[model samples]
Target: MRITQGFTFEAAHFLPHVPETHRCRRMHGHSYRVELTLEGPVDPVTGFVVDFFDLEAAFAPLLQRLDHHCLNEVEGLENPTAELIAIWIWDRVKPAMPMLAVVKVYETAMSFAEYSGG
Candidate 1:
């Protein structure tokens, strides 16, 4: 079985190398959604794959970095595409939660990317 939790943050970004007329070239923002999924045998003590609160804490630092800031200015994300952002988040939180199975980052209601692996 798997358990998943969702969180949202707003951040701005621009594709610096894109032509000026490109829609994504200008600075803009998205109501970003981050979904973390944990897969494994559930922990008997809590009867959960992972505690939601613990997951929240694990992602807190990453949330701070992405919340209300320009993604381009965030360290290590000079070109914060959705796929890169998902990987960046996975790198930060995976060490803390060894059972973490995947990270899904949504740039829009219909657009998203996922990353997983050790």
Candidate 2:
């Protein structure tokens, strides 16, 4: 079975690689939504792929670094685009949540990016 947990954080960033005329080159904030997905056979005893609470706890430290801050200043997130943020989150949380199958990041109501530990 596969399960996904959603979390949100607010952060500011700018894409320095973008053209000077591009608006994304200017710092902006987003109320970002992150979905962490895991896949595995259900544990016969616990009846869960993994405990939801444990997943939340495992994600807390990463969130602390992202929530209410300038993501561009965070290590490994100098660009902080949705695509990069998804991958960065995957890398940070995968060590603790080995079953992690996907990291989806929503940059806005209509836009999102997904990373699968690739």
Candidate 3:
């Protein structure tokens, strides 16, 4: 079974590695959405893979760091593409959420990326 929780934050970033003429080269902000998916068997006792509150607690600190901040200034997010952002969140949250199976990042309503560890 898989249980997923979503979070949103607003931050600005510019893709430095993209071509100078690329539109993304200029700074812009996104109401970024990240979803954490935890995969495991549902426990007979709890009837759920994991408690939603536990997931929220594990992610709150990272949310604070990412919200209203420049993604390029975040320690591991200097390049900050949707793909890299997914990887960055997975790296920070996985230890606290061992069951985490995927980190999905939405740069826009229609564009997103997913990372499942390696």
Candidate 4:
């Protein structure tokens, strides 16, 4: 079984390569949603794959880094594609939670990308 936790952050981004008149070319925000999945044997003491509270704590710094900021201005995200963002977050939070199996980032209600085991 897998356990997943979700968090939300608001951030702005612009795709410079797009036409200047494109709506996404202007700095705009998305209510980004991140879902992290943990896979492995559950802890016998807590009877959970991973503690939800612990998951939230693990993601706190990440959330702070992205919340209310311009994602395009962040280092390493010059384009800020959903794929890049997923990988960026995975890199930062993976070490703290060894059980992580996948990271899914939702740019909108219908669009998202998954990064795993990298």
Candidate 5:
């Protein structure tokens, strides 16, 4: 079974590698949406792969760091593209939740990226 939990944070960033004239080169902000997925057999006794509260607790610190901050200034997120952000989030939370299977990030309603530790 697979379970997913979602979170939201607001942050600003600029893609430094983009052309100087590109709009993305100018600092912009996003109401970023993140989803963390975990996969494993559901425990018969607990009836869950992992508790939602536990997952929330494990990821709360990450949310705190990214929320309302400038992603370009964050240590591992200088560029902070949706793709890279998904991977960065995966790296940080995977250790605490070995069942973690995917990290999905949405920069906009129609634009999102997913990472599965590959």
Candidate 6:
């Protein structure tokens, strides 16, 4: 089975690598939404692949670094694009959550990127 937890944060960033004329090159903010997915067999005793609260706690420190901060300034997130953000999240989370299957970052309601540690 698979379970997904969503987290939201407000952050500002710019794609420094983008062309000078591109709008993304200018700093902007987003009400970002990130979904962390985990896959595993349900624990017979706990009846969960992993406890939701435990997952939240495990991700709390990373979340604090992202929430209300400039993504470009965050270590390892110099680009801060949704695609890169997903990859960044996958790297940080997989250590604590071996079952983590995907890291999805939503740059906007209509756009998102998913990374499966690949």
User: Which pairs of residues collide in model 6?
Assistant: none
- Which prediction has more favorable TM-score, 3 or 4? 3
Candidate 1 at residue 62, lDDT? Answer: 89
Clash count per candidate: 0, 0, 0, 0, 0, 0
- Per residue, candidate 3 scores C-alpha lDDT tens digits across 1-118 of 9999999999999999999999999999999999999999999998989999999999999999999999999998999999999988898899999999999999999999999998
How do the residues 1-118 of candidate 4 rate in per-residue lDDT, one tens digit apiece?
A: 7999999999999888788888888888899999999898977898998889999999999899899999988888888878899999899889999889999999999999999966
- Model 3 residue 29 CA deviation in Å: 0.6
Q: Rate the local accuracy (lDDT) of all candidates.
A: 0.91, 0.95, 0.95, 0.90, 0.95, 0.94
**TM-score: which is higher, 3 or 5?**
5
Pairs of residues at least 3 apart in sequence or in different chains that clash in candidate 5: none
Cα-lDDT of candidate 5: 0.95
How close to the true structure is residue 49 of candidate 3, measured as C-alpha lDDT?
95
Can you tell me which runs of candidate 5 are displaced by over 4 Å?
Answer: none
Scored by lDDT, model 6 comes in at 0.94
For candidate 2, list the clashing residue pairs, or say none.
none
Clash pairs (backbone) in predicted model 1: none
- Residues 1-118 of candidate 2 have per-residue lDDT tens digits of 9999999999999999999999999999999999999999999999999999999999999999999999999999999899999999898899999999999999998999999977
Give candidates' CA RMSD values in order: 1.3, 0.6, 0.7, 1.5, 0.6, 0.6
The residue pairs in collision within model 4 are: none
Off by over 4 Å in 2: none
* lDDT, residue 100, candidate 2: 99
Tens digit of lDDT per residue, candidate 6, span 1-118? 9999999999999999989999999999999999999999999998999999989998899899999999999999999999999988888889999999988999999999999976
- Cα deviation of 76 in candidate 1 (Å)? 0.9
Worst 10 residues of 3 by lDDT: 84-93
Better of 1 and 4 by TM-score: 1
